[model samples]
Target: MKKNALLDAAEALLSEQGTQALTLTAVADRAGVSKGGLLYHFPTKEALVKGLVARVIEEFDALVAEHEDGAPGSYSRAYVEATFEILTGEARAHRRWSAIMAAATDPELAAPLNEAMTRWHGRAPDEDPDPVTGVIVRLAAEGLWEVLSHTPELYGTARLDALKQRLLALTRG
Candidate 1:
């Protein structure tokens, strides 16, 4: 719980104040813990970043599991629904993803994210019966991620939610 609090503090700091204010001291302060305590959990800034990445992956995996269990056996539909939640800011790290992306400088720091992406995409069917719709849905979801990661301010949550609904509809069709 303390670890999660520290990671949450780090995400809030980075999202609200940008990377410049995400020092260990600042995170400890925001989390209302001692610097030493924070260090006890995350010995370094890189470690904190890794923890944040892992948290994101863990949250994403849970959401995917939720969708998978709901649909029972449709990978494409579950993947699309999960992607929609992510793009629509319904997912936990939707707003704070930039924080993790910014801190993912080192190879080790980036491995978890890269591995998650690879595994998630691997679950996407390589050859769908309706290739056109699948391609469209996949590209649209990827495009939303690019836009969300680069400049999310251009689209408010409502707009993103609307877009997600349309994208999910496409996936269904």
Candidate 2:
């Protein structure tokens, strides 16, 4: 819980000011914890970044699982729905993820994120969908991510929600 609190603080700071404004001291200050207490949980900034990456991967995994456990066509449908949520400000947690992704140009942060993505994507599929279709859909989603990560107003939540619905319909067809 303490760790999550710290991550939450870090995410807010990162979103507001980017990696330049992030520091263990700042996280401690924002989280209302002592520097020593913060250090006790994460001995270094690198550790905290690693924890943040893990938190992102875990959250994404949870979202995937929630959709995967239900009815047919859930994977593609959930992917679109969950992504719409992320891009539409329905899931504010993505701001932190965008920050982390931006920070990842620095090796200290990038490595863990790379590893996490690798593991997540490398996982075996139960019944893999068409590879080409999957790739195209994922690329479209990536395009949406690019838009969301850069200009928050690039697309409104309603438009994105409708777009996702259309894409999911197409994917189902």
Cα lDDT of all candidates, in order? Answer: 0.71, 0.69
Look at candidate 2 and tell me the lDDT of residue 42: 93
- Residue-level lDDT tens digits of model 1 in 1-173: 38988987887777677878778999999999889999999999988888888877787687677876433224555666776676665433343374456456678877888888788666545444455676677667767776666676778778877876786666554
Worst 10-residue lDDT window, candidate 2? 120-129
Count clashing residue pairs in model 2.
0
Model 1 backbone overlap count: 0
Tell me the TM-score of each prediction against the true structure.
0.77, 0.80
- Misplaced by over 4 Å in model 1 are 69-73, 86-96, 124-128, 149-153, 156-158
Error of 2 at 54 (Å): 0.3
Residue 98 in model 1: shift from native, Å? 3.4
> Using TM-score as the measure, which candidate wins?
2
